[model samples]
Target: PAARVVLVERSPEMAGFAHATLAHPGNAHLGDRASVLTADVMLTGKARGEAGLADNSFDFVIMNPPFNAAEDRATPDQLRKQAHVMEDGLFESWIRSAAAVAKPRGGLAVIARPEQLGALLDAIDGRFGDTEMLAVHPRPEAAAIRIVVRATLGARGKLSIRPPLMLHAETGNGPAERTEMINNGLASLFGD
Candidate 1:
């Protein structure tokens, strides 16, 4: 709780929702320690500086950049479409932004669709090294649907692929007994 968390989101509506949720009675404990800044981090400048974010100054950077190229959909929500639809060079821009602000030896993480892992690695190739990937699957027997890539800036090392993190039990397995510890924080893969 000693560290401050500043969330940067490009969507104004989403950023407002984050602020409102964090200020809600049940989660108000964040108090003033957490705040959201609406900005396109890829082009952050005066806004970033005002928020105390300087080039190569952040301890780490985490990005959930949009990964899907424009897709045909029925949703009428323009905001949702804008958020999910990706443009050319979006990933590269996001990776560059993270590298620009990350301190030397600082860590960076990007959550992306499984198909984009190669592009993600290429984008971070020079600015971040010692890359590792954690694949996330819906269940132990399912193929990974996404990956979380973690890297250290300015380090030299080989890439490591970690075991997949399964999010659910397989069908017909029945519900595994969950203890308070498990429900609260303990995570497992149904003993798989």
Candidate 2:
């Protein structure tokens, strides 16, 4: 059977955008394999289950939760600010939800600012293991802008950090080959 996806979105506009994107002719197959549920992701496991996120059912969970500190320069737009700013306990809540829904040995992947890696790891502790992180740098000499973390539920393997992914060429403005490949969906952070 084809893999099915259940997307949870809190914003009506985003939900509508998701639906419209899926409904596009080029994405008909994806639409057939996916469904969108409009709801708060911060809800309790039981509440989420009631909203169609059954516990111990999903084989994989991926997220790009807001990681910006409240003190970070806020976006002028309220909606964008809300989407980019992180609230207290956000990581814990999201990871708790991920753990609840994922089957044993299920995979969890997250994209976050490099500074949030510690918080993310702490939240995953005792729930997901065998964690690996890949740093995303804007250029060869620049500090990492983001990190992609991957882990497996119920596994005990030690954490590992993968090679950094450079988005831009060492000295040029254009994107690196790998970055282009990844942007085009031809590659993955996990090298899978």
Candidate 3:
């Protein structure tokens, strides 16, 4: 009922599992609308390009790439450098790939640890126009653990830094009402 969707996985076994899981009646409607590809992203640059995944072809690019940094030089045909180096240069390749395939005015959403925010920003290289950041804190007084950032390609604008979202209650027992409210807000934002 909608446009096509593509799923890329590095493992064949995982790809098969995803295909099987999506083949159920509950998801039968997605037939022919989705495809699963088993390919190592770091070594599939040519394949990706051949598949018409050229620059500015997508409306959005979302990824949660591996965070290990010690395998950068182990592969001779890696398409991304940051895929292996968490802090060395892996993110840059991912961002560059996203930017290359994202439409000129498309958007990007990435969820990553708070510590990676600086590296993410550096990789964006001003290609992102407007950006909004949401920090997630464990408790009212605890520091942020993660962050969600939404950015647009080629659309320079001001950054909107919203207040931190607390994930736990003030009493530190569990999630409080405020935590629920924050969760609801995020759900609404994502049209859930």
Candidate 4:
């Protein structure tokens, strides 16, 4: 059987769009395996369960939470602002919710700006362990702009910083081969 997936979105419009996209003919194969849930992830576990998220049920939870600092320039568009701007303690709140829905020994993966690494690790400290980080660089010599973290719930392994994933080449040709492969779903950033 295909793995069941639930895409939780706070924005109703975005959730509707996701549902429609998943229901489209092009995604027919995935239509039956995935669902969209329009609900606030900040809700308490019981509240979330009432809203369609079963507690301690998901095998894994993957998220890309807004990481922009409040001091950053804000977008003029309300929707964009809501989606891209990070409010106070939002990161921790999201992590808490992710942990709530994850099963014992389940995994959690998060991608965010590199600056958020410290906060991210702090947020997941007790809830998820065996943390591993992968830096994502724009080019070979460039500093990492983003970091992808993977951790297992209820684990105790020491954190490991894996090799960096370069998105672009120094030659300015285009995306690196690994990036292309990942974008096409032909490869995973963390190998199986």
Ranking by TM-score: 4, 2, 1, 3
Which residue pairs show backbone clashes in model 2? none
Q: TM-score for all predictions?
A: 0.84, 0.92, 0.72, 0.94
Query: What are the clash counts of all predictions, listed in order?
Result: 0, 0, 8, 0
**Per-residue alpha-carbon lDDT of candidate 4 for residues 141-171, written as tens digits (9 for 90 to 100):** 9999999999999898879999899999889
Which candidate number would show the highest TM-score if scored against the true structure?
4
TM-score of 2: 0.92
Query: What does candidate 3 score on TM?
Result: 0.72
Order candidates by lDDT, high to low: 2, 4, 1, 3
- Decide which is better by TM-score, 1 or 4: 4
Per-residue lDDT value at 72 in model 4: 83
Please, what is the whole-model Cα lDDT of each candidate in the order they appear?
Answer: 0.78, 0.90, 0.71, 0.89
Per-residue lDDT over 1-192 for candidate 1, one digit per residue giving the tens place of the 0 to 100 score: 786678988788999999888889997788887888887776766666665567887788988887776763435788887778777788788888788788889989899999898899999998899888888777777899889899999988878887666656676444333322345557532221
lDDT of 3 by residue, 52-112 (tens): 4666677887777665545534656444443444545666877877787788888887777
Residue pairs with backbone atoms closer than 3 Å in model 4 (clashes) = none
